[model samples]
Target: MSIETWLAFFVACWLISLSPGAGAVASMASGMNYGFARGYWNALGLQLALVLQIVIVAAGVGALLATSALAFALIKWFGVLYLLYLAIRQWRAPAQTMTLEHRPIGRPLSLVLRGFVINFSNPKAIIFILAVLPQFLDPGRPMLMQYLIMAVTMVAVDLVVMAGYTGLAAKALRLLNSPQQQRLLNRSFGVMFGVAAGLLATVRRV
Candidate 1:
């Protein structure tokens, strides 16, 4: 990829990461429950899923998956169900005062897995990547190297964006002093997750 093409892709990466989706909801949810220090593991899991998606696209499996109605439906339903599960969990979270120091720490691996599932199950992401990544590809240049660059660029941007989302929620948590306030915020996040699931359920291959 030339410098100009790479630069354009880099900008696109930021925009993609900034867009609100299941990943953002997961990040904020984790941050709300845990603080930035532990919640950031969710971002790592998200990056892992992202890299895998890029690899799938680069290897051309994304095209096959996109065309397969059964595969797409399976993945899409899984994602929707998972998001609804998350929403229910959030809704049922015990009401407590907002105190990061006093709150019990969540297992990092569980958070990571949560993040991975949130991204990995989204068929829309695979299709989006399949459509977008090829636009910057140079048929005259080596393909593997271009894919590697794009993957790295996308992951780096997404990490930063997820961190910002997580941190923002953590900071917001500090302002809520009562259990009522905490419960309200938690349920709000639950609703957000449900909304995300609804949106995901409506996605169709383009």
Candidate 2:
């Protein structure tokens, strides 16, 4: 990618990162409940999804998914269900998202995969990548390389932004000391997740 293209890609990505979305919400939730460590894993999961989204966009698989109504809804609703499940988990346990020492003990491979799936289950991510990536590409250039460079830049920026958000949230959550407050906060998060799932379920396919 040329300098101009790089600048544009970065600027757009920066704005998108700042927007409140599933990835940001997840990162913030982790930061609030678990602490910076869980927030970091959450952010990692989010960045991984961005990589997948860009890859799908670059490979032109996006168009196929878009054209197939059944396929799109299947993925979308599946994403919704996954989000609901996550919300339920949050409600039941409300584990501190930053428990580096006493966190839910699991296998390393499974932890990594779980983190990845948490972000990848959102179909809107794939659609967003497909719809937005093409606007930055030039048909005459090496398409793959162009997208590769752009996507990498995007993911890098996103990581930085998410980490910062997580840090701030972790600090804030540390302030609330009461058990009642913690319970309320967990319930609120569950509600937010449910609302998000509802929104996704109701979205009209484009």
Candidate 3:
């Protein structure tokens, strides 16, 4: 890709990532509850999902899935259900305070799995990749190589932008001196997560 093409791709992906969505919700949750350390991982998980999403779309896997109505519907419904589940969990769980001595109690595999489901189940992610990427793809280049360049450019932008979000949220965490305030912050984040999930479930597919 030309320098201009790469620049444009970076800008496009950065703008998209800036949009408030599940990834942002997750980042905010992580920052509010666990501080910047966990927030960084949350951002990492979001970027990792983007890489997989871009690869799936670029290889024509998305085209195949788009063609199969049953497959699409099944995935879409599953995404909705997953979001609803997350909404309920966040709503029910009490607020948690972060400390230098204590850690959130979840298995590593389970944590990553939840991250994957939160991202992968969202069909809008696939659609976003399809719609945003090809506009800048070089028709004269090898398709796979073109996609690899695009994916790298996109993920890099997403990571940096998401890290920025995490940092800003972490700054807010520094203000609270008491566990009670931290608990309230946690509940506030939970409400935000529930709202995000509800929004996702109700958004009609185009």
Candidate 4:
């Protein structure tokens, strides 16, 4: 990829990372539950899924997925169901003030797995990657190098964006001193998750 092409892709990466989606909701939810230090593991899982998506697209499997209506519908319904599950979990989450001394710190691996599932189930992400990433490619150049550059750029930008989301939620945790306040926050996040699921359900193959 040329410098100009890479720069444009870089900007696109930032925009994609900044967009509100299940990934952002997952990051904020983790941060609210576990704090920044522990919750950041979720972001790592998101990057792993992202890398896999890029690899799939670069290998031309994304084209197959794009063409397969059955495959797309299956993945889309899975994503929708998973988000609904998350919403219910969030709604039923215990409302209690989190403190360093008494906070329930979730296993990092579990958090990572949760994040991975959240991103991986979203067929829209892979479809979006398939649609957008190829625009930056140069047919005359080696394809692998361009994909590698894009994968790295996307992961790095997303990490930073997720960190900000996580940190902001963690900071907000401090203000939620009462159970009532915490309960309200939890339900609000539950609503957001439900909204995300509804939006994902509406996505169609482009």
Q: For residues 95-173, what per-residue lDDT tens digits would candidate 4 score against the true structure?
A: 8876655566889999898888889888888899999998999999999999999999999999999999999998887
Ranking by TM-score: 1, 4, 2, 3
lDDT of 4 at 179: 84
lDDT of 3 at 69: 66
lDDT head-to-head 1 vs 3, winner: 1
- Model 4 scores a C-alpha lDDT of 0.91
What TM-score does prediction 3 earn? 0.86
Please, what are the lDDT tens digits per residue for candidate 2 over residues 1-206?
57887788889999988987666666666777667765567777777767887787677887887787887888888878877886887677553433344434434344345457766766677788788888888888899888888878888898898898878877766566665666677777777778778878887767
Which residue ranges in model 2 land beyond 4 Å of their true spot? 94-115
In model 1, which range of ten residues has the least summed lDDT? Answer: 97-106
CA RMSD of each candidate after superposition: 0.7, 2.8, 2.4, 0.9
Candidate 1 lDDT score at position 157: 94
Clashing residue pairs, candidate 1?
none
Best by lDDT: 1
Clashes of 2: 6
Q: Candidate 1 lDDT, tens digit per residue, 1-206? A: 99999999999999999999999999998888888988989999999999999999988899999999999999999999999999999999999987866765989999999999999999999999999999999999999999999999999999999999999988887788999998999899999999999999999977
TM-score of each: 0.98, 0.87, 0.86, 0.97
